[model samples]
Target: MSLDSISLEAIRKELLDKFKDEKITNIIQTKKYKIIMEVKPNNFLVLNGINKKRDTFYIHISIDPSSMEIYFSESKNTEETISSPFLNLLQNHLIGGKILDIKQPDFDRILHFIIQPYLKFGQTQNQILIIEFMGKHGNMILLKENTMIEGSIKLVDSNINRYREILPGKFYISPPSQNKLNPLNVNRKDFFNIFYSLKDKSLNLWKLIQNNFIGISLQNAKEMVLQANLSLEKDVSNASQADLEMLWTSFNRIINNIKNHIFQPTIFLDPLSEKIKAYSLINSIQFPPCHKRNFKDANSCLESLFTELEKEREILSIQNKLDQILSKNMLKINNKINDYQKKLEEVKNCEKYKINGELIKANLASIKRGDTEIKVINYYSPRQEDITIPLNHKLTALENARLYFKKYKKTKDSWEIILEQLNNNQLKLAQLAEFHKLYKQYSNSLPNLLKIYNDLMKLGLSKKIIVPLKKQEKKKNKLLPAKYISQDGWEIYVGKNNHQNDFLTFKLASGNDIWLHPKNIQGAHVIIKNRGNKQSPPLETLIQAANLAAYFSKAKKENKVLVDYTLKKYVKKPKNAKPGMAIYSQEKSLLIKINLPEIKNMISQNSQGKILSP
Candidate 1:
């Protein structure tokens, strides 16, 4: 949720107080939408306004559209930061600068940082950095002393916003004024009169208050409804005198809080979704038991809320991309499978051509070259049924028989080849489905996501997932499968991706080893190493390996799961098959009532610290 002007006002006051004794030390561009300014306390008299090591903090300004905010955080994480042209220009003018003053023009969602840069021995200079927190139109611009635009993080021309353009060499203009009445100045009489002056009384009271007030958001309006205990959906026309008085009292209370600076800086979280339900400098009320967090200042409150939001956004973006790539490739594969099946049906008619050829051969003496049709009986059918055959009158009966035999031979040959191709496509589709399950088990993981992204690149299904040149060499090494050890000390390995599965099944496993998998489910391939024992592993060892398979499958959450186990020698990779595809025989199924807690503990104890947790 984006901050309203009220919350921003509180944040501005909170930051201005802390920054009075501080100066900017550095400016870091953390991500596409966020920047960090390292600030610390300064001793202007002793060190030419250079900052000391004490009282250092970061001013984090974010313009992510979803959460446009500027707040002070205790520490800065420069791990993901990279340099940009704008960042370098900002550092040149902003570093070592002290905020001489901060302004909120017309009490809008904007901040003007008037800064004095570290100058030469006798010269003086100042710069203005304007940050606007308008949702979906947020921006940061550096301006000259006279408000001439120097640069901006985002560019808008006449086509984007005709009233004003933000570009280099243009005079910086303020945003258009929202000519709503200031809530801080409204009295009870003015409030009632304003409501009555609007001829349309059919408006909802909650929306009416928001439409007529400056710096008040929808959350503010909803909070008024809760505090006044009035009907939340009541229209102005339906409201009694008592309801209007209650709303006036509720509205007056929040305005007084703003005037007195009695802020709560609260974040209310929905219990079910565990996400921020509402954020304001004033307390919020929500239904079904919300978790309320109160902070000493608005800056801390916003920092905590948006950190969770940013993480959620990053994961969602990756997931949507994975879905898009898979959807495109899966659709292509399904179309091929459909076409092959249709061709198979046409070739299945080869038996009829063979029957016609045999019947013509049996009746060759009775048929003449001028005959157009013939019926033969007492031949191929046990009951001697008659079969009608259409003939080419210009050709001899013997020649017609030869043509039929040739057509039968050609169709039968095509049937064998196309059947193999169709089977391979079906097997590849199944392998992809299994790989999707493994991917979801670590959807929030960066390493797993990159590994899967690399896998897709190899399969030629994803070209848009870019890998940096620096990491290209490291990506050449394949990701190892998840490894574990059984109670009997047999090493077990589970493959998290198709390539890893192929390596585990054929390259790493011995012919006498035991293999286990979840039955009819998308999951990992697990192998229990025999380690040259040359004998069968105990039943308990088999169960432990089977448990690993069930835990990693799509059915991991089920109370009861079925697992299939077989010898490695029985598994054979089909010709022209995908990396993970295999045909196996002599398999046995294990029905398990899963002990989820036990399985989790076992994983933590035996997994060799390689499980990629989401």
Candidate 2:
């Protein structure tokens, strides 16, 4: 909802109440696009309105407790309570006079503020004060009885006529315009008739007001619909009597609400902190509590908050890519390792290499005769000398041995490097897997937290909702669990992930705080605690928090899972560790598949509006 209509209506109602019986004293131009009128009751009603949605321009009305001061401006001057060029003119000329008449140019649709007042000059006779309010097409003129003293004009002279003709002893009239609407006589019924009769049947009430109604804003039109209890898009012609009656009731209700100063303002949520700090006079039904970063801090922070969420999503994308790359590299290294092992086995199984020792011993005698090249000529050596034959011309024995040794060395060295690389790849893949696991846990936890925040806000405790800051405390290794608490003393703490299961159990927890988590699958670490031993909570409360944790975690929808629980003092966060990672000892696990309907019922029965159920 826009605040413009609400503020304007409030000011207008106030003025109408104060000046119901008062007469205008005098009217004068305070400055360009500004005017002031003195009233008999000595009370000035300042009316401020902004035509643009931007905050730069504003219409202001100031009323003094004793002798009211009415001022209006669209300038961005924050120092003075009431300051405007129009107001300045009114103050100067209409301080102690009375209004004579008001005129409207039917052709130009221009409103003129005319006043006759006794002046201090000469004979103390009445002088005319003329001011026009018809946008840029209108002008203001001042006259002394029947004679014009001064006039505001677009041009001083032209090829056809001189502007001085309107300076003195001249009449004033508005210029011509093709389309116009008289604001003074416009009514709600006329608005309905005119808009309903238009060719565009899809036009809603707000659209009609924006396009056809003179001086009526879209915000005001929406407010009117809300007030009348009539759907803005409902066809007026087809509306039943009952609908019309309801519409009238709604309209009256809104009008009454405005008159009685009952307005709910729109709370501005901080995108960075996801907290609300300021409010405007606009009616908004819901407040989105959790906001993201990386958005422009304009009139609304929602856009920026979404941008932050998008960045997180992008991070998730990058993480997935990294995981894929690591997986592919690990697979490639494993394949190479397998190939090297096969090659090494083949070399070891080679007949020549395997029988080389026996062959050398048998040929020892032949080899010692200075016969560098020798070959066995018999199937079985009857005698070493008898089996000897000169070596053929293809290759020498020493050269063959050297070549085999060289091949063995190359294979060994290559295999070693491949094995080492494979081992390193496996380690890296493990680390990547761990990283992906933790990231998923963190991502899952965020939505649950946001849902909790929203639910809390609905209960009107939005101001109390806070984001947990990361903190580290070093002591005698005592456990400190995480949890959320309500104003009425209900508490819930979720763990970072499964790695923190032990920490959530052994440290950071008190004996009194209830522990809740998903049954078996890896999920958030949830702890519901009582700050003191005030009283033991009901079983339903524990179940509700547990169900939420399971729903938000990686667990698929199953009948039941096991959830372990212990005191916060039992759970401990390890040093130099990732978020949501913890250690816990001597913990008891509960096998409870999430019963969403039952848990919801229990939440409704126990906490109702006190705790956020969604």
Give the top-scoring candidate (TM-score): 1
Residue-by-residue lDDT tens digits, candidate 2, 1-614: 22233444433444444443345544443233333444554444444843333222122222212111222323333221335444444455556655444433341223334444446684554545543333333344555565455444332333535433443345643344435354334445764466446787565655554565444456655655655656667765556667655654554455455546666534456676544433334343233434422222122232222223433443454445434544655566567657756665655534343234344445555454344455554434355333333432454555444444555566567656756665765665565465445434343243333333333345443244432221111111122334444334576655544434455544555766666555455677776767667576666666556665776567747766667666555656689767566566667766667777764554455443222221
Model 2 TM-score on a 0 to 1 scale: 0.35
**RMSD, every candidate, angstroms:** 7.5, 17.2
| Top lDDT model | 1
Instruction: List runs of model 2 lying over 4 Å from the truth.
Output: 1-193, 196-206, 213-233, 236-614
For candidate 1, the per-residue lDDT at 208 reads: 90
lDDT of 1 by residue, 279-303 (tens): 6778666444347778887777888
Model 2 clash tally, residue pairs: 71
Error of 2 at 405 (Å): 5.7
